[model samples]
Target: MSNSARSLPDVAYVAQPGLSGRLDWVGMDDIQAPVMLVGEDDQPMRFPARVGAFVDLARPDQRGIHMSRLYLHVDQALSTQAVKPALLRTLLDGFLASHRDLSSRALLRIRFDYLVRRRALVSDNAGWKSYPVVLTAKLEGGRFDLELGLEVLYSSTCPASAALARQLIQQRFRADFSTQDLLAREQVAEWLGSEQGICATPHSQRSSAEVKVRLREDVESLPFVDLIDCIESALQTPVQTAVKREDEQAFAGLNGGNLMFCEDAARRMQSALDRDARITDFWLRASHFESLHPHNAVAVASKGVPGGYLGGSTV
Candidate 1:
């Protein structure tokens, strides 16, 4: 009826029962949406993701931000065409456009599971493994920081346990058979091959490679696959996808050869990260879910510049 032309105010308005002195930043957090996008595997994937966003409401006396508009902007973008990095940027950019007078910055986050088809070690038969990927972006002063994070599952074995098993088997064989009557080495080796207890370690389960990268501001390329591969290769002990008997044997051999404790796995990943020139900084955590113990064993490492270690002083 009036000149405004808009039917009604869309923002979530809460009538303050009692007024406060001031409120700085008040917005929405954990709003969920199913967004369509090309996954890291380069195929169309839809994500039912939760978003956490915040916006600043200006004026020294203002109470809160427009929470409804923020949620609506994210929902609209999520419901649009297949999401790419560029499209996500559009969503963050649009938040500012929708509320021009409210704030200078808008933060957006989307968490989704990325399904990757992996082949079996013995079967070449394909199956899906889900990796959690998070897409995050921030817009302020016409600059955007885009970050993509992914987690890769791998495996490892314990070297100390393997060594102990070998020694124990040899000792048992020697004790059971006389020194003059039987040679322990050949008998122990055969027993080790046959015995289930000595064949593998106590704690051999899946390990994960977690990687996050800040996309180059000028370039549009997000090397998601390459980043994942680099992480897997760094670990050097990924569980096999497709396998024949030979593949299974090879996988077993890899697990045996790369016998590692949690600390060893962490060090290996760290060394690999330090060797790779593509990453700016990296942090790695290697965990071994214990079969014998109730608690898990873990090790962590981070990549830091060697300014002071190379004779320069620390900040």
Candidate 2:
């Protein structure tokens, strides 16, 4: 076959004229692309990410966006370099440059599961934990903005339930022991070692906190580990990966010490984010998948800055 005969003509994308209407955003989503990112160890790691690429249709007369160009540029950029605010800005520049007169703003969102090895509490072993993460970048009128979003899972023990359980245990102890028996440590320890000591246990539920932060202009690197560390430290009971007997005991102690409701979790996260200089603004939602109730309990908090995140806004 002749080489010229194999050439396919590009028609719809090249010659077709779309309806004359300005679009707020236009481009592709769920595009699978290989991306390089900084890991917890401050080393470059590669992962497959689901990406959404877009640019605003500022010119109504323009036929359509060059979607293939956007895809190609993003694919190339992500494949070759680690994703950062500066690199994302460059990618947006390429997006606008490809569209020329058709677009004035560009945006990109990438979602992936970030894996971090976590050491077990009071144990020598460690295991991998996966965190859902999303990175968003926007470029408009020569200005760029970046946002980072992630979720951390933890255990939330209801304080009210704990207090109620403690009361029940005290009643049981009084009923089981005479006043003289209560004075003997051996008798008291024997009774406490039995299952009757904890006749009623406080209700604990798995909880998650979804957090989004707007990055400051001077932030050069993605602070994934730092942000996760801050959140985990504030919460004080991140879901464990590996569990030994000692680890489980330590985790139980942590749960007992850090009993909280959804509102408490939200406030803790808000305070932690407020102290972070790299974050200009933050939105946090703490959800408790209640074991005692059929529905989940949720609380939301933000930096409360004007024109920042509003209540109940999706990250």
Candidate 3:
């Protein structure tokens, strides 16, 4: 080491007058970093993540924290190892250790696009879909907490619209065949195949479900794919990728069968999440971007656990 570099004075050690106050959180946000994550298939993949690292400034007299130490720890821990509960705990421990008495609570948030290959509804072709995901870890008062968040897109067909469309079709059929009695089977079949037979179609819109779950501390793995599967199973109309004619037809069938309002969608999600034992608490919001109206339809739900998410509408 150069003698000149060692002789440089550090200003953080010299507390200026009127600068002694504690901060709730002190660190950096929107830091670009790479992290290795294990997917549902147990494959390790590297993803670019936007990271936020912070520590509470517990010591009132301290001027500031060692921001570089937090950044370096995050970079070293995430870049080298696959992200999980244990690794996150160690990273938070490092933050508190580096700051010593200056901080107590440490929190880390990583946001990334989790890519998964999805198959068409009834075709051999498949394509990749990117889901926006966030993983958060917090350590405070000798306790560790972890939360996972995800967003899934699907199709939502209004049930009232479907019923109304069916009524319209029935009325059209009555008007077309009112004067004819004992119609030929082939003639009726031809009329049913025509566009005039099924004129009115129900309104369906692309919808999104945003969910956040607090996992039990003993949980070993991140359940990103499991949560996605549960949501898709309940909704049964996830937006498709790499569609063929048959696949599109099948998707249409599924949407037609699984007609739901935003409230029904939210209830389905709530019921599914309630059955998962690993999740201690959860909150979800189902949003339907309405095609008939300019406004969107939305429903929100929560696990309603004591000392947990309080059923807030935001997701």
Candidate 4:
């Protein structure tokens, strides 16, 4: 037999469909890939990201989408280029171009753990802290949108609990010391330095703030570190990774000074987000895993931007 004849195969025996409907989104998820992202220092940082790529199938007669084309385009775009809003726009353009008749919109979401180096409070030591970060981009009807999501962990001391604990400490102090002993400054100082002085301690729990913000058109790069800094500064009690005796003491002092309820945390995050001009809209959820209770305390806040986020979805 001839080589051409042997290589030939049946071309008409492919899967066929009778009818097809328009799909809002058609693509892949949990795609493990290495992507290069621009960091806060304006340097390229590479990370393994879980990516989701989708495009709207507008054509109703199409049997199915070319899934391999979407995957290949994503691989090409993310592997060589640094992640930014502009690059994402180009990627979305490519998605629509590759599927000219079938797709009209494209969306991409990349989730990764970003490592940030944090300095110990009141100590020279530092450690690496990982923040769960997500970047999402969407292109629809010739308009592009970008959003950034991150979670910040901190310590939240209950204000009401703190007051109750303070009252108990005062009662204990009065019971331990007579009226004449209270007048002696040296004796009182010694008593205050002892562990017995603080007989009761306020309840504090590790809390997290999950925030998502839509970026303005003028923003050229992702501001992950800046957002994290703003949240930590507002909360005043970010959890520490590296700790010494002095560092722990300083962290405790910070928590004592910044006692807050879930409502306070949500408002603080909202106020901090409002001052940033680069953020057009935001949704924040502050969750306190209460130590004294079996359930978590959560407060949600969002900027009521018309036609923007409605505080319904975390994505």
Candidate 5:
């Protein structure tokens, strides 16, 4: 075929426009891609990510956007450089520049699982834990915004259940020892160690915290590890990756010391996040997937900044 015969037609531009209204966003979703990330250890790694790239259709007369151009820009930028705020800003700029007069706003969302090696509570063992993470960047009206979303799984012990269980244990001890005026320390210890003496146990269930934070404009790198550390520290009962008997005992002690309701969990997270200077605004939901009940208990909190998150239970 001749070179002229092989040329493709640009239907989006050449075809007669039927749509007359502008759109808030136009482009694609679930574009499968690979992104590079630099971990806290300064090692670069590649992870498979689901990406969404879009640009606003500012012109009402225009038929459509150059979807291929957005795809190409996403592909080139994500595959080459590590995912960072600067890279995201530049990519959004490219999205706008490609459509010059046609678009004035751009957005990109990248979702992936970030794995971190975590050590056991009291053992010399470590294993990898995967945390779900989403990075969203938006450029509108010459303003850039970056939001980071993450989920942390931890253990939540019901404070009410713990109190009731302690009451039951005390009753069992009094009944078992009411016959004797004076008891030896060894005998009492043996009875306490038996399952019959400690007749009841508190209920604990796996809980989840979904947090979204709008990062400060001056922050350079993604603070995934730091955020995770801050949250896990606040909760004090993060699910273990590798456990020995000693580690299990230590975890049990932690759960006993940190009994909380869903509201308590939410407030703990809110307080911890409020201390971080890197985050400008944040919204978080603490959900306790209950063991003693069929329904989950949840609490939501926000930074309470004026014109910030509306205290919704969403990420």
Candidate 6:
């Protein structure tokens, strides 16, 4: 095995002696790879996107780290508008093919800011903002795991608690059946200010919608946007990304009528996800940054993972 006859790296980058330490994988995170990822833009978002990649490198006995090859695989897949679970699965398959002797387990993480324009409630003014997002993809034993997460900003209107207070306040008063057997919400609002009502509507700002689903075998598509729409609609007081006065008026009316507590928000979201047929399994978390309290309020529900979905147990 003379020098010319020996194997050499097919890539240009060189790994320094013992530079990778004992870690099985290491590489750039902010390394931007242009992608037209599915479920993102209705049109292709072909700008540079950042991804965190890891390739298995065994003992120091190995000759080279296939870093460039790994990047190339990512680039190639991303070149087409074909980035999703299947694409990632193929990339991992390619990675394993390139490093046959190394371990088969591979991990890929994509972290990027997703921006959408929202309409302001009353002004209908357009505002552009970004949401922090992360996608975790892993391949092992010929199967792949994909997770997509979105943190959404919203406001929760405390309806249940308000109703409770209205009930408590009106229980002892000179209430009559002529009262229409129904107390107008406006009446409840006035009674609280006039009497010993412990009622208050607290708005929780900056809520998050976090969902992860298993893509089923026969399913043709993943309704990521539709799910996002359902989740946002369930929030009732979803903050606007683009708004006109009409949108604002609609939103304000929504706040007035669809008051919800943190618990209510969680249940509403759970119901929305449950109605979605595309998702095989789901996990939901709602983090509400409270305006009235020092600490945030949070509620969580998952299908089959919690006791059951919608804050229930035993399915």
What TM-score quantifies how close candidate 4 is to the native fold? 0.92
User: Of the pair 5 and 6, which is ahead by TM-score?
Assistant: 5
For candidate 5, the C-alpha RMSD (Å) to the true structure equals: 1.9
Residue-wise C-alpha lDDT for candidate 4, range 195-262, written one tens digit per residue: 89888899999999999999997688888889999999999999998999999999999999999999
Off by over 4 Å in 2: 1-19, 40-42, 178-182, 311-315
Q: Write the candidate numbers in order of decreasing lDDT.
A: 5, 3, 2, 4, 1, 6
Q: Model 5 segments beyond 4 Å from truth?
A: 1-6, 313-315
* Predicted structure 2: lDDT: 0.90
User: lDDT of candidate 1?
Assistant: 0.67
The models' CA-based lDDT, in order, is: 0.67, 0.90, 0.92, 0.88, 0.93, 0.65
Reference-based TM-score of each model: 0.77, 0.93, 0.95, 0.92, 0.96, 0.70
What is the per-residue lDDT of model 3 for residues 1-315, given as tens digits with 9 covering 90 to 100? Answer: 599967977676566526667789989999999989887667799999999999998877777888989999999998899988899989999999998878889999999998888988888999998889999999998999999999999999999999999999999999999998788999989988899998899999999999999999998888878989999999999999999999999999999999999999999999999999999999999999999999999999999887789766455
Q: How far off is residue 146 in model 5, in Å?
A: 0.3
Question: Top model by TM-score, which number?
Answer: 5
State the lDDT of candidate 1 residue by residue for 1-315, as single tens digits. Answer: 475736676333434424554344456767878877676556677768777776656543444566777888877777877766677678877788876766777778778776566666556576776778777677888887777777877777777777877777666655655556755587556765676425434357777666555555554555556666677777767766656787778778778778878788777777776675555555556777766677878776666545212221211
Q: Worst 10-residue stretch by lDDT in candidate 1?
A: 306-315
Q: Clash pairs of candidate 2?
A: none
Overlapping backbone residue pairs in candidate 1 total: 10
Q: Rate residue 140 of model 1 by lDDT.
A: 80
Global Cα RMSD, each model:
5.0, 2.7, 1.7, 3.3, 1.9, 6.7
Clashes by residue pair, model 1: 119-241, 119-242, 120-241, 120-242, 120-243, 121-241, 121-242, 121-243, 122-243, 122-244
